[model samples]
Target chain A: MVRPVNPPASWWRSGLAVLVVLGMLPVIGNIFRNDSSVSRCEWDGQVMRPEAAVTLELAGRSVTCCDVRCARNWLASHSERPTLIQVRDEHGGDPIDSADAFFVRSAVVTNRANGNRWHVFGDRETALRHARESRGRLMRGDEHPFAGVRGLE
Target chain B: MIVNAYAILSLFVCGLQCAVAVWLTGRWLNSRRAWSSGWTDDGAEVVERNAYLMMTLALVLLGLDLASWPLLYLLLQSYVPSWPGVMCIDGVTRIGTGSLGASRFLPGLLVTLQVFKPLVMLIGGAWLVIYLANRATSKAPLMRRLLWGLLLIGVTSLCDGVCTAGYLLIPKQEDHLAAGCCTQVTSTTTTRSSEPLLAGVSGTELTVVFMLLWAGLLFLLLDSIRKQRSGRKWMGGLLAITLVVAVLGGLFLVDVLSPALLQRPHHCPYDLVSELPESVIGIVLFMAGSFWVAAGAIASFCADVPETREILPGLQARVLFLGLFSYLGSFSLLSVQWCVL
Candidate 1:
């Protein structure tokens, strides 16, 4: 018959307890570090600057994009039409409803990921002024960058 | 074949494991033969020596193999810079798809390795625990059983070594292909594939289901601990529950937590890991919890053998406690993150 031996020592149990406790230290530390202050683009996963951000309401959630191109591409892919589309004026940094905004596809790139050079302004005069200085053309209503995009139309 | 420090180290580890596994196989056969035939006085000493050597080597190799799983990902991550349009480890796996050569098979080989490595690690870890428990006894009555288990582990390790070598040595067409990154792959597939699993279940509803499964798992684990033994039926039920919980946990991470943490609307775990490294802790906790629960179930099952019955209960209780602690820790961490978000 096989004899039963005494139970093993408790060292491993203590070691495991220590490990479980140690695993929580980093998690505790992460709680204090806030990352929400910087807004990120939903389409390309890039940080969105206030001047270059394109915001839209899709499926009851606010979606932010790095530029007009990303916003258009995102809209083109999704079947649901956005309820609202808003862009920031390049000069004044004020939110402008995309319907009333003037677009300028300049040589200046706003987001490097997609090489998006499209700029938006709240008024036609500012758009024309920047277009002349940057040697760019002002886009008309039909020629707007997001004209063909499903939700933006 | 993009050569780097990580690749070189991985190849070296695999090679060493292969060699050790071969040596272990020889010792296992010898030990089995001696045990079955009933060794004489001097032969018994040799058998004992061989058993000790085999156990020591197997333990070390298993430990190394466990560590290699994470190292495999890190190695793939290192290759990202060499492959154009590859933003993360997901793209690195698709590095050589355009080529019509052995490199085209790289992704398949890596995927096989990914699946095989976890199975090998889980079995190897369970074997290690059993061996430790048996070793604590005087006569080591479980030696015969352990020898067979060791042989099984050895064969798997050898196969794993071969697969790892194949994955590393194959030359990848890095620059020409410019494989699509996670943005293209994960964005389209995650939502579509998860929809079937969700079955019209929203994220909030899934969270409730996940929490309920966790609660059930906790109850089963605590009951097992209280009884000081797990019935076979309960063990199977526990494993099933653990599997569902793990799957739902992964879905939760991909669909909800990852996007929320990254502040993006897409589902990509690679981005989450790359962007927020601390999230790895919660993942580790979840994985560890799952492993311990499985280990405890295996321990309880092993108690069926007459010789191990006396000692395995204590081991089972300890492992179950670990499982409970790990699961609770993971849940708490996720809760904290949800609150913060």
Candidate 2:
């Protein structure tokens, strides 16, 4: 638990602090609604959940989505492909280059964009365990079915 | 996304929640001394004043915390064309997520808080409702319960502080560093190796569990009303079941119902509050029902106190009815949209 907010240093100190906070703020609408050019869930055209966003670098453009499923689906359907596919690692949650990642399809994990039904993992061991548990099929980034996309190579 | 517009205000909000937690805890500790002395009428008045201030401040903070979630998204968006290549909320969120290293998890935590913030609001709202229903009960277990609730928020607010700091640390997203959308972000990453454990539980299974859990909560609500026992047993049962229902129902929302509601295969609880039509109504009903049940139970816990006994039953019944109706009502409406209608 957080320690208590200490008593204000003094009345003027409190006022100064408030002013500083106010000065740093952007417009109020930006606080409540989005103004960025990237779409929330581009696949479904809905506001993306900050928790579930699946981001990929494709076709020299950014395709931000609701989940990995949509990103994967989009990559599969598109003629132009991503130069690099960086999927968020399930364990570390750091975005990993897709070529080095492992994937599982038809798992319980739901995407915010087009419920495409897939998850990405950084290691093969965990992905294999997930397949065993969730009845998912392994999607190896190194393999063709999953890696058919190549851009301007 | 461009430093969230609300980021600065969040510092104050988080500080207030921590302060309120501290104040309430101090009061709780002091109560032992106050009890031993017995409330001299003067002491009683002072305590009452402090209690009222703490609760009111806590509620005010909760209201603000709830509002800040969306603002976090917009703050990034406002950074916009200036950021170049960063077009949407996703671009704003993912850019840092990819480069922020260990702190990348902060954005995910902020989003998960979406499920929890409303619960804090419900707990606070329930306290307000119970306080309105009976003044006499405010002195007993109700105060202790209120302190615990605030403590929960205090702890969570600290997470907010971390996330806010992390957001600040993230440099402006470069044009070459953007990612896809939320679908890719939430599904692909396993923050902890343990995440795979959640797999295999299909959407259908989650839906069944969610409905069953809510049904159990409704049963508890009905029994509380039918017996009007107002004992610890009844109240504890009610509180416990409501908690499970909320937790399970929340998972279901993220995993199954959200997709069904949008008539697509997307899942994001925050979307329920977005531009979607009538989404807020469904969310409000769910919260109303859950909070009402909680409020009624808290009131019941204080029922045995002689001063509050007379008003307890009447208030409990009304509150329970509101909670049960709204909780089930949300499910019904979603069901109609998904299946029945």
Measured by DockQ, the strongest candidate is: 1
| CAPRI verdict (incorrect, acceptable, medium, high) for model 1 | incorrect
Q: Which candidate gets the maximum TM-score versus the true structure? A: 1
lDDT of 1 by residue, A14-91 (tens): 646655664565556566555467677777576678888988887768888888988887776667677788999888
Question: Residue A104 deviation, candidate 2, in Å?
Answer: 29
lDDT (Cα, 0-100) at B294 in candidate 2? 78
* Shift in Å, residue B164, candidate 2: 4.9
Candidate 1 TM-score, true structure as reference: 0.77
Tell me how far the alpha carbon of residue B300 in candidate 1 is from the true structure, in angstroms, after superposition: 3.0
Write down the DockQ of candidate 1.
0.21
Give a tens-digit lDDT track for model 1, residues B254-305: 7777767765555666665556666667777788888888876775555346
TM-score of chain B only, all predictions?
A: 0.86, 0.65
Candidate 1 lDDT for residue B28: 84
The local lDDT score (0 to 100) that residue B139 gets in candidate 1 is 77
Candidate 1 regions exceeding 4 Å error are A1-39, A47-63, A76-143, A148-153, B30-43, B97-99, B174-201
- For model 2, the stretches where C-alpha displacement exceeds 4 angstroms are A1-153, B4-49, B69-102, B108-119, B133-198, B219-223, B226-229, B270-277, B302-304, B339-341
B128-147, model 2: which lDDT tens digit per residue? 65565545554464554555
